[model samples]
Target chain A: MNEKAYFSEQIRLYEQNIYGLALSILKNEHDAADVMQDAILKAYSSLHTLRDRRKFKSWILSIVHNTAIEHLRRQKPTIDIDEQYDLAAPEPTVDPETRHTVRAAIEQLSLAHREVIVLYYYENYSTGQIAEILDLPPATVRQQLFRARKALSKHLNKEDFDR
Target chain B: MTTPSDRDIRRQLEAEGRPAVPDFVHQMTEATLAALPEKLPVQRRPSPFKRISAAAACAALLMLGVLPNVSPAYAQAAGRIPLLGSLIRVLTIRNYTYDDGSHLLEADIPHVEDDDNAEAAALINADIDALTNAAVSRFYHELELSGQGYGSIHIDYETVTATDRWFTLQLRVTETAASSTTYLKYYHIDRQTGRHVGFGDLFAPDSFAALEAAIRAEMQAQMDADPQIDYYIEDEQPDGAPTTLSADQPFFFTENGDLVIVYDKYTIAPGSMGNPAFTIPKSVYEPLLK
Candidate 1:
């Protein structure tokens, strides 16, 4: 009914998903935390203009994405540590010697791929939900998942078996 | 052997995200909730014709010896009539000059009172207005003729601080995309109260771009009365920040010393009356309120 109760309820409903969205974009805990703060702050500031209740998740996610992109722009370093390792054949993940390598490979993928992976696997969102959250077509989301899987499989040194 | 299923891949990757969100988010939410205003400021700028008329009025007043000698009380009362006249003319897209002091052009959009979806409807209504304005005029006409589309007009309102030119109106619209039921938004500024109130539409629309043009023509004339500044749009980012023709951050400087910036993005749509009209934040162009 009141502004406080209104937004607080919204936060309660999608806060975790929002955090998860930010984490997918930022990767690291500290940056993701900062992005979360920025997203929530912006949403709070602009909440008065919002009219639709059903689109809150998508709306909030859009805010989170914009804030994250702006933050990333200011930082100027597009960091994807795990993505680089994915390019190279990684070590066996069952062993600790290769677990770090596997992690590195995951990070080495492009931010776009990493985003799909994070949303699909890490956040437990279906491809459809991920597509809506990211404002992408469902087919595109499916394709990204396909590519992300191929890339991750290659890095895990399981391309032969996995593919 | 078959490859790992998409579901399997999804499960494996889901493990990588943060195990938990920090405790501060709750604290931040509390702080944010506490910080939110009881009433949200309407962000719509005044209509373009209102801005032009305001400018035209100033130019006319300065040319006549009448502006300097005019008393504050006489000017205030006189100022409103021209604005009301100009706005009615501009919004109707017909030339009209009315001397009647009692007439006020009011656009009403009735919406649902449900709080859950009000904000989204408000945002969409505004967005649709802005998007239509930015789109080419022919594109706008196509939308209009199809009996299904949205449109918007850019309005800039301004006047000297000495002259009291405040534009006020109550706007209402519905957003069906957000809910099954309609919502009503009361977009009005109490010139006496200085209070700006806005909410969502009351009913769902088969087509949301119902009232874009009529409201635009009406609001445009209201804004054209104030002559504070003029602007043109360089670029617009839907779902992102607007890029303005202004060269500086916030308000930019020109060879002449006037505060100028592209402040509004209007949407055109069908109204409750089934007429096309515009909707946006009145505050964006509230610079003219000065």
Candidate 2:
């Protein structure tokens, strides 16, 4: 296939993953859409830079990761400290209602924590893959997953009190 | 109710639905393809003197209204001809205007493709796009929160050198809000191999100490020669001098191939001093060149 055709096929196959990754990071559908478009154009324009075709999935996702983070950083000057809580809190009860609570809790996570969790659990990316896409150390990705899970549990448990 | 185990949480997360891709993806793909240059235009090869004279003539004609009647396409094609083509070409890829009229973003992004250095060109383009996007987005976000000011961001690029052996492109970004500041970034490519060059790549690996010493000595002499000139002095300065230079510090080569070390505002001096740059002649470090 020609270059444009190849780029289009690759983008078509990965569009959902790219959108999901952006939404996970930005936590806003509109911003996520904007990031997805920007990332696609950028990837298409620079496809020749891909040295290893085997790593195409990670390469495209890395663009989405950077674009989303850039969008988030532009949206706010300071991080919301409230999004980060103590990770040693007790786990919440796993009732059917916990399923409803999970998404909301995920939205409350800091951008860094939410990214690893979504890439790992939702996208089924390994820690190594997530680290590569996010340009972070694998050890750091694992640590983020641990803290993110704890934070989610704490948020879900706190929701029970509001009820 | 029992507490949720990590396994349970993981299962639920996996089961959660992802956001749907928007309809705009196809539109964006089409737009991108349409914008892609189908074939690389033949480079306008002209002697240095002729190129300058032609550029000057074009500018003169443009100012005289003689070129105004020409169609844009015709003008563009004419401009790309060997005698009329510009030394550097910059094109606007994207622009953003806020609904509230509080801010504007204009990106005159660069791309290098269809050349011997296509891969290097792609890398340079990607880096520039990332930087420009991040800066514009940050400014946009700030404007959204403040909701009371006017601001503009512009990113433009220039070709510092475009020879067969070496290609250097420089990006100048100006962001204006309550205040304005311009940041400079450069991309240097070894055109033959399509490899990006960093500050350390220009010198021998083991010659960092000599470079640092030379730079420090030059900086000191410059300060001594002019009382108005000053660099940041570390509080612990045994000799009241700046710290040692890092290999990764920002630098670029002059037309004469001299090295100019650049420090961002407040990096080596106070913000009022702006970005301070010192040129070290090639003679100073000729032995260090790789």
Model 2 chain A, TM-score vs. native: 0.79
Which digits, one per residue and each the tens of the lDDT, describe model 1 over residues B1-290? Answer: 13356665544444543456678765675565566456432222222111122333334334333323222122122213233332211121111121122111111112211132344434433432332222112122222232221222222222211112222222222221111112221232223333332211111232123222223344456447633211112222233333312111112212232222213321111111122223333433333222
Tell me, by lDDT, which candidate is best. 2
Candidate 1 vs. true structure, TM-score: 0.41
DockQ result, candidate 1? 0.15
Top of the candidates by TM-score: 2
- Model 1 lDDT, residue B262, Cα: 19
What TM-score, to 2 decimals, does candidate 2 have?
Answer: 0.42
User: How large a fraction of the reference contact set does each model reproduce?
Assistant: 0.14, 0.14
Candidate 2, clashing residue pairs?
none
DockQ for each model: 0.15, 0.11
Deviating ranges (above 4 Å) for candidate 2: A78-101, A157-163, B1-6, B24-290
Q: Which 10 consecutive residues of model 2 chain B have the lowest summed lDDT?
A: B41-50
RMSD of each: 19.8, 15.5
Give TM-scores of the second chain, every candidate. Answer: 0.19, 0.59
Model 2: per-residue lDDT, tens digit, B1-290? 23456677666655655656667755664565566444321111111111223343344334324322212121222112121134223343443333345456655555544345566666666666555545544444445433343457776667666655566667777765423446777778775566887777777557767876666777688778875555544462211234555555567777677777776443454333566777788898787878
